[model samples]
Target: MTLIVTSSGRPCAFSEVVEKLAARRGEKLCLGEVVEAFGDRAFGPVMFFFALINMMPWPPGGTTLTGAPLLLLSMELAWGRDELWVPRWTERASVRRSTFRKLIGRFQRGLKLTERLSRPRLHFLTGSFGQGLIGIACVFLSIVLVLPVWGGNLLPAVAVGFFSLGVMQRDGLAVIAGWLLTAATVAVLFLAWRIIVASVSHGFDWIGRIA
Candidate 1:
């Protein structure tokens, strides 16, 4: 039901493949193959791509992302600007354009921050709340994807891919497994950050002593 049809109004899976491939390869692979080979589960791939896009860096002192082009970029990246048949959930269930705003609304319900986070949370972590959680990750990812930041898309992309695929296939164990993977990933990132900071601080201190 949440599956979006293509602009051409046919069942598309470009997005779905994007989600899956990103889970495994991030942006390293060829976009065209991903878009064309997605076969049936396009939403996943599209959502994954957006998740990565959402992490871009905008101007200084700005955390919000841009719009318009983000949607177009997603479409292009997922379906290729060529004549590829991209699938989108029909307009009946489609939620484009204001996707970021809608997600913030969902996250805000029980959350103190903006509600956008709620879409994915409700879709994957909790059902029966609003629309399916699949959109949560997709919309959130799309928000970050529109930004200008670097490396910002990785975590969210992976998270959304895992969550979306898990929910779509009804793989509850996979959901829990994803949580574990996420925790491990976070721990690794934190440790790496600490090491980098320590190394830099040590280097600066040594330089100062020598000077």
Candidate 2:
């Protein structure tokens, strides 16, 4: 489980972290190991990774597994915590290495392109106060993602992923983009919930008439 630490004592790039995870292609990849791998650079990368899993076309209940971490991380960020801490149950949660590798490969190219375009700008937005705001938004989005709303997880997941990337790379532009996407996600979820409520209400009215 030993990994090479960069001169800065953390993985220099998110892709390198993925590569390290990929290298253990047949073993169980636990969240604790990932937390250890990121060391001092835990929050952004881990949040990005968890949200990325939700963004993918994975099996049902994926969010159930991923959403908890997002919630925990968001709370820490909002609280201005410098270090991440997860419960033992969460840390012990894992996925098969081969599955993780396949998932990473699926989106690696697009992520690389994003990396190329990203740069540190708008420093104020990626700073502590800004991150606290983003984290508050993430807490709401994470709850939305965990719900069983049909086809509801994608937008929030993408928004959270972008936010994580923005923080990781200190790309203020990306953080702005993430905020825009989060707004859109919230709007869509609100509309969806309204529609569901209307439908349920109509159904109950019809049942009352029948009786």
Candidate 3:
């Protein structure tokens, strides 16, 4: 499989690769045909791409909407004049396979709306809806990232990005993990927000008395 980065510099639709992996849904990407097709050495880069996209900020109006800048950033990081690969194991195959399956189910559910649109353009077009959501997600994440929130809002962005790539590549396992992570992140943020609000209110009351 060709893994060249797009002009925007992000790895091309991981969807295709993911799809191939999905066929082996009962097993791990490392266990069977996926390794044969993508090769054992390529696993590092593939997982790296998945994690990077998984953790990235979402595009505003769908992929095309806010994905351009992300693509550029990815390009700079992956293929810039000084580009280099940094390997990090995001998860094990056993865990990731289950996570990815769950994520794909969610993506499939959302696709119901697009399916009704009936316009091929509207359905596959990732620029508007995908990017818009991602953009909004990024802003939310930016706020959460600065706060003490665990996982932060970035998880959702990562989930969406992974979903996008996974949909394109048909990688259900990655998608599952993305969604799980996103959900966990959001939960953490909700808890943190409550804590911060309570602390701020307590602090204000303590500082107001002149006596």
- Name the best candidate (by lDDT): 2
What candidate 2 gets wrong by more than 4 Å, as runs, is 1-11
How much is 74 displaced in model 1, in angstroms? Answer: 14
For candidate 3, write residues 116-192 as lDDT tens digits.
43222323323334433433443444333334333342564465455444333334454455456666777876887
Estimate, for each residue in 117-172, the C-alpha lDDT of model 2 and write its tens digit.
88889999999999999899889889877776657788999999888988888888
Q: Is candidate 1 or candidate 2 better by TM-score?
A: 2
Tens digits of per-residue lDDT for model 1, 1-211: 1344433355434333333344553323433433444433454434434433343333431323333223443344333232334334221222232433344344334322211222233333434321143343334444644454455445644555454445444444434544664565557567877998999999999999999
Q: Candidate 1: worst 10 consecutive residues by lDDT?
A: 110-119
Q: Could you tell me the TM-score of candidate 2?
A: 0.90
Q: After superposition, how far is residue 84 of candidate 1 from its true place, in Å?
A: 21
- From the highest lDDT down, the ranking of the candidates is 2, 1, 3
TM-score, per-candidate, Cα-based: 0.39, 0.90, 0.34
Task: Pick out the ten consecutive residues of candidate 3 with the lowest summed lDDT.
Answer: 86-95
Order of models, best TM-score first: 2, 1, 3
Relative to the true structure, candidate 2 has a C-alpha RMSD (angstroms) of 3.1
lDDT of all predictions? 0.42, 0.81, 0.41
